[model samples]
Target chain A: MAASDAEAPGMRPWILMSPALGAVVLLLAIPICFILVYSFWLRSAVGSEQVGFHLDNWVEVLTDRFYRDILLQTLRIAAISALLCILLGYVPAYFIARSTTRHKTVLILLLMLPFWISYIIRTMSWINILGVSGALNVFLLWTGAISEPLQILYNEGTVILGLVHFLLPFMILNIYVSLDGIDPNLVDAARSLGATGWQAFLQITLPLSLPGLAAGSLLCFVLGAGTYITPMVLGGPRDAMFANLVFEAIITQLDWPLGSALSLALLVILGSVVMLYTRFAGIGQLAKSFR
Target chain B: MDETTRYQRLLERFRNGDLERRTFLTLLGAASLGAGLTGGPLKGLQRQALAATPESVRFDGWGGVVSEAFRKYAFDPYTKNTGITVIDGTFASGDEYLNRVKAGQEGEYNIFHASGVFDYARYVNLGYDVVLNEDNIPNLQYVMTALMEPFRGVTGGKLSAAPYDYGTTGLAYNTEKISKEEMEQKGARILIDPEYKGKIGGSGDWRTRIWYGALATDQDPNDIKDMDAVWDAIRAHRDLALKYWGSGAELMSLLAEGEIYVTEGWSGRIAALQQQGHPIGYYDAPNGYAWQECLMVLKGSPLEACEELLNFMLEPDVAIAVAEGQNYPPSLDPTKVDLGEKIPELPAFDPTGKLAGLTFASPAYWNGNEAEWSKTFGRVQKGY
Candidate 1:
């Protein structure tokens, strides 16, 4: 590769990279530009897209109480789900990362086993597990915990639970990567300085693992905020998220202008969270979040 | 290797004007023909090539178990009656049909099934829906005139879409949970009754929720222009409706589980559920929501062939087969057909006189308030 690079310094690099550049321009940049342009367009009465420029969609999105409330609710739910993911995901990741090579590999493999099945199937399974007349209630009744079936699903509690379940693996893997990168000698040195076990973890381990935590939080928050299925399947009418609004506008009403506007708003709002995270945590940490 | 060498030598000699042209052409044709008849999608194309020039018209409609009935009752029978082949494609709504046509595919499909007034009006307004005449479709006379009036497809009050099977969004309850007295005392207002809290699964697919919510608050679904009051009732009723079903399958699952006691339900699905041995009861509210699916021929489509197909579907035996397969009531006279013995909910639906009570959603009203109503409903859905 080094010899080839030296041999073909004349326009070969640009030629080699052109396909990937074209793909990015075609797939990502163009569609995003389209969404931006369409957000300002209009829907005709005949269900056709009309090309024009208008601020009405933006105005309506900002002024309307319905969009405002749903957006706010989506943010709240996303934040809670992400926090829960961090709280729950940290323990397993710490243990797994601290494990020997063989055990850590097996644990990581076990964590990814459910990915073979679909997201929809996983979410629907929760319904059977948490439905009033479903497995959990049956188990509780059998154990004589209560005579009546508890309303476990179609509520806020179940929605958050489902989201956490969905997002836990991502959080764990991210944190595990960061934890694995931390030199064991650092924690040992902290302990040798007469620091307690908790002190060693708090000083050497916790500070080092912040990058993974931030990355996982970003993934979980963005996904949970935009999730339509978790709410649609597990939660009730009062559980619809912001994605549901965008979907209804585009699919149900065929109102592209409005749908695009809502999508842009969602992206911008969610994007700001990441920017803020990067600022507070440092851009280098956020960049390493994905891997 | 020796045989191949000899054959190459012979072929080389032939190329040098030693072998006959007839022998070469025959060998080549035989080898290609044998392989062509062997396997794959090409075999199907080969069979088509061998058959009579197939007279066919492409159709776009909804898919599911019902599309199977379309094949058994309509497509096969229509093909038998007239030699036209009916190819099928699936689409979600009239929205897709219009979009596909506008994208330079106007001639792709001849017949389409459009539902809801909003869907039908788009085709009509875009000059895509063809005007119908009773001469070609003599069975039009038998269809209930009440179902014939198009939402907005008219030239001085004449309908466009040939009325097909229709469904109503009324309350479906488990008889084991609800009592007859409740039905009589409250009617559709039961949707908002505190007694049924966390027991109702209101369908949250469309603006239909607002219509039902209006009924719960003693407002007429037909004249529900009052968004303020409708939104209020809808939000209020959301407390009672603990589950807002997104699909017919989801609603059916809830009903089967007995997780819900009552909810806004589809007519066909209720009948189908009953047939499936579910002990569910469908009560058609005299002042509740309803929408009918209709047939339309796109302009510049295979009009005559699609017309023949439509007429073939109207025949009693064929129409009955198709409608029964769908578990839906036909648009024809209900008293004439033995529907009560079949669906059990037919007599109550009262397809003939029931038109007065069933409020077909006004397309203009919905299209105008779509964004506002959709956003409101979105909030209600995720109110937590």
Candidate 2:
């Protein structure tokens, strides 16, 4: 009876998990399998897909200098954007975590307000702020700061700026979670031992927050690398990311095989990043940020 | 054989006393069970047994004033008359829209406001087209033969789309910055001019880029022998361009804000800007890019409902109203229909109805090279 009871518990967990396992298999794994199969097919001259096993798409993706350069550029942009997010995000997060204010929930709620607006709208809002006749230029011209409006909207810098805007809250929230988890007594203990406030923070608080910072960086890098819209909306002709190439392949060129290959390439790279992060930072810290 | 023929054969066999009563009954029951389980004709029967009328039909189009006009003049009135809902959707570009339609199920996308004969040919080749009964859409007679003929030629004399409007991708310049004489003199070459560097914008569309490139190189767009020179011209334009605007709204915004001094612009969008009192001057260069828009009924659509909607949209009052509202000239031949005053004043207005003056891309030529040129253009546009 005891052996049967033990087996029942094991089977109960599996039964309980079956729906989620089924969902993952049906929604995620199956679609990826389809994409993998499509990557081997050939696109006909007439734009319809030719069903066959072919290595042409994979060969081009792996060997082409164009794809390599675009992929490298995407990684570079994503790294810069993530680093910028860290530098800009840590201060507000520290303040919020160490705050003695009563309306802390309100502050956090305000931080989440940007999520209420569409991401595309938020990306596009930069055009109104940074365009030649936009608010910044208008304000600058009104103050006689410059004789002419600065042409500032469509460029690589603006694309990064848009990414940072979209990703800042995520960084702040993750870092804040890390900061909040550190015991206040640790800083007090350091301070009591003749350490300055700065020394206490550097020695105690910053070290504890490293995991959340890494998690936020991972999230930001993966998202920034995968973005197509920001560059399409606020970027110059030369500021396209890796995702835009996939878009051009599938939509403009009607080459689904090439697009599928390119997309899988991106997925593998980003997935490797996540796996590496998991190896060091115990992926559980990523979930703590949401809570 | 069909279910009816099989049933009749079974009945005849039984009446001829070729089978016992119990054996006949067993065979009939087995046939019924097989038909129920295996479907085939039963699926058709099930569909026929369902609703005779569809609840709603979907129509996708370019947004902004175009959608507004259709809503106010065409779809809204059609819905009011027929007691059916029109689900209006918007697409940023034809390529993006085609990708979406390809990914979706048949009948999910009932109609599309498609651009150009090449796009029609692409759809036909992709097998997304549906034949419309001409007798139902009686108002198709008023459309210009010039506009209709190209689409017909693409589909081998059967149209999957009704030509609705026509426009040109002409050079739009900031009038305050560039003189009309300079624009006319420079023509397509102005986009590649060194002085206009960092002050020019162009459509991000591959076809528009290639079309302008061909013109800049003094080659016919329909038949380009030296593609290297055209590519060089495109490279020059790319280096000089400030931005590649994606939508009509962005094109107007760029010209209106003076961010770009010169770029290829849509005739109707430029007209809209001019009407808004922006200092934008539109001049179609010699051998300029001209194209027509069509309302295409996709396969698996409820044919009668979509036909009714097309007929309503093609009416003189609705077409003229939409034309004036969106600033594109209607497909109605001015020689046949009195298209009122505003359409006559619109950009790319074809009073002659022959459209002999405007040059259009040959579907065979463009669609034939779509797989290669479109992919190559993607690389070239990004500093290749």
TM-score of each: 0.80, 0.92
Clashing pairs in 1: A237-B381, A238-B381, A238-B382, A238-B383, A239-B381, A239-B382, A240-B381, A240-B382
The clash count for each model shown is 8, 0
Q: What lDDT score is found at residue B234 in candidate 1?
A: 75
Tens-digit per-residue lDDT, A14-80, candidate 2: 8999999999999999999999999999999888799999999999999999999999999999999
lDDT of 1 by residue, A160-257 (tens): 88899899999998999988888899999988999999999998899989999989888999999999888878887777789978877777667789
**Candidate 2 error regions (>4 Å):** A1-4, A282-291, B1-52
Worst 10 residues of 2 chain B by lDDT: B43-52
> Interface Cα RMSD for candidate 1?
3.3
lDDT of candidate 2 over B1-384, digit per residue (tens): 865566567667878998787887676666545655876554332222111335788999988777888899889999899988999999988988999988865566888999998999999999888788888999999988889989888777888899999999999999999999999999999999999889999999999999999999999999998999999999999888889998888898888988999999999999989899999999998899999999999876888888989999999988998888888999999999998878899888878999999999999999999888988899999999
> Which one is best on lDDT?
2
CAPRI-style grade of the A/B interface in model 1: acceptable
* Candidate 2 accuracy as lDDT: 0.89
